[model samples]
Target: MKQQYTHTKLIELISNGGEDQENAIRWIYSKSGWVSIVKKMIRNLGGSNHDAEDIVQDGLINFIMDVQKGKIQKIEGANAYFIRSCKNNWLNNFNRKLKAREIIDREFNKEETSINEEKIFVSKEIWEHLDRLLEQIGRKCKEVLKLWSMGYSHEEIAKLINYENANVSKKTKSLCIEKLKNMGLNPDDWKY
Candidate 1:
């Protein structure tokens, strides 16, 4: 497709800055087909229109800077060069994301194994602490906590312990947990 502004005209306008630069950019956005081309390329890469817009904006800014810096003076192929810059941005971003995903996957495997081992250790410690704590707490508190730790629901515990309601059972469990904390047992050391 034809560009609204010639390579020389756009570069010269961009280099002049101020109104000329603004017009050059406005022409690129409103008249040139380059933006659509860039957006299509990005969409083909599984990117959203927003991503295309951002990358294209960055590419335009960089192109204008290059012109102002004398790095793109009288360039006959600025259009191709500008489009290439956008493609490079997309490629760099894609590579960075791929690297991040790879790192997370690598760490997750080791982390998952360590997390499993930690869970086992913490579970054992909590049960041992509970056993010793049961001896010190009230009988009702002991039974409530044991059943709670064993995965019994508040409703079930209420029925078993003859509490007025599930709320009562839940409150009793919270109180028992608080007692464990007061006795220097740190009930939440591993979140029982």
Candidate 2:
């Protein structure tokens, strides 16, 4: 018989990272019924097998990232969370494709038109700058900011990062945010 993983064991393995990270992902893929649910959702939406595979991959990556950053809250169970996340992602992708098709049809039917390419270029530049600023901050600061952005309580952050206490976690996160602001990064602009 195949081994089965409980929700608690899965969460511990995923959150722990390092050697456990790969195993956790493998367990998720191999042990859950959620994968079939995701595939069925996509198929019902007229997605091909390739699309199902892609959506599953993207969903897993997003779910893992959210888990690591502590963005997930109000957990009912691991299977439900994974299925919901994948369904949402697939729906979003389908909507984006519909919008793109509409835009392309409109463009083909119209003649030359004005587009504010400069504004887009400037926005891209600003984002690049922000990315650089984030990288400039030390690794620890980045970790703290990420966890805080993910909506982790100070106590939770402290336990995750091995800090002495919640107070220390709060102080460290505050200082990191301040440093980011001094370097021209608006804390409000960043999201997990």
Candidate 3:
């Protein structure tokens, strides 16, 4: 257990900027185990330990800088302010990622993502075109699309492609689609 500080005392110590500042930062990090509390909150909010670590680091830096720069003169509590900053950071990061994914989905989904009902990919001519396109991309691009079109789970694609995890496989699949789109893939062009 660590001791808590009054906002005035914390502000003074941090403003002075020396050994006092280091100790003040330490107190803020460990007082009543607030760092663990922050990390737990992040995990509860669907973030990973790595994300928690990043948020905590950024929060500490911003808090210290703000206090030193006279940006935070009064506060109900330093802990609340610090945690709120981190929560906002996480939410912002999550939204940015979500928006990026939406953009990728829109770009990759201009046409129907699925092929013919038989899964032979419309016709043999399309297969040849796809083969050429896949060659331009990479061998794994073809397999990723094939397995994905066959309804194979991302976890399955990860194992098949030696990716570290499902998330990596999913990102790879997105990249493949982006590459194909860059190569001017139009399903309508392959239609007889």
Clashes (backbone N, CA, C under 3 Å), per candidate, total 0, 0, 0
Q: Model 2 segments beyond 4 Å from truth? A: 111-192
Q: List per-prediction Cα lDDT, in the order shown.
A: 0.80, 0.78, 0.79
- Estimate TM-scores for all models: 0.54, 0.61, 0.53
Q: Give the lowest summed-lDDT range of ten residues in model 3.
A: 113-122
C-alpha RMSD of candidate 3: 18.7
Per-residue lDDT of model 2, residues 40-80, tens digit only? 88999899999999988988898888777665545758788
Q: List the candidate 3 regions with Cα displacement exceeding 4 Å.
A: 110-192
Candidate 3 local lDDT, 1-192, one digit each (tens) = 447778888889998778999999888776746688889999999999999999999889988877865778867677788888889988977875665565558657773343332233234566787778878987787888877875679999999789899998899889999999988787665544
Please name the candidate that would achieve the greatest TM-score relative to the true structure: 2
Query: Which scores better on lDDT, 2 or 3?
Result: 3
lDDT: worst 10-residue window of model 1: 112-121
User: Compared with the true structure, what per-residue lDDT tens digits does model 1 show for residues 1-192?
Assistant: 645777878887887778999999998876787889999999998899999999999999888767766777756688788888999989977775665565567667764434544444355467787678778888999889767865679999999889999999999889988887887875346544
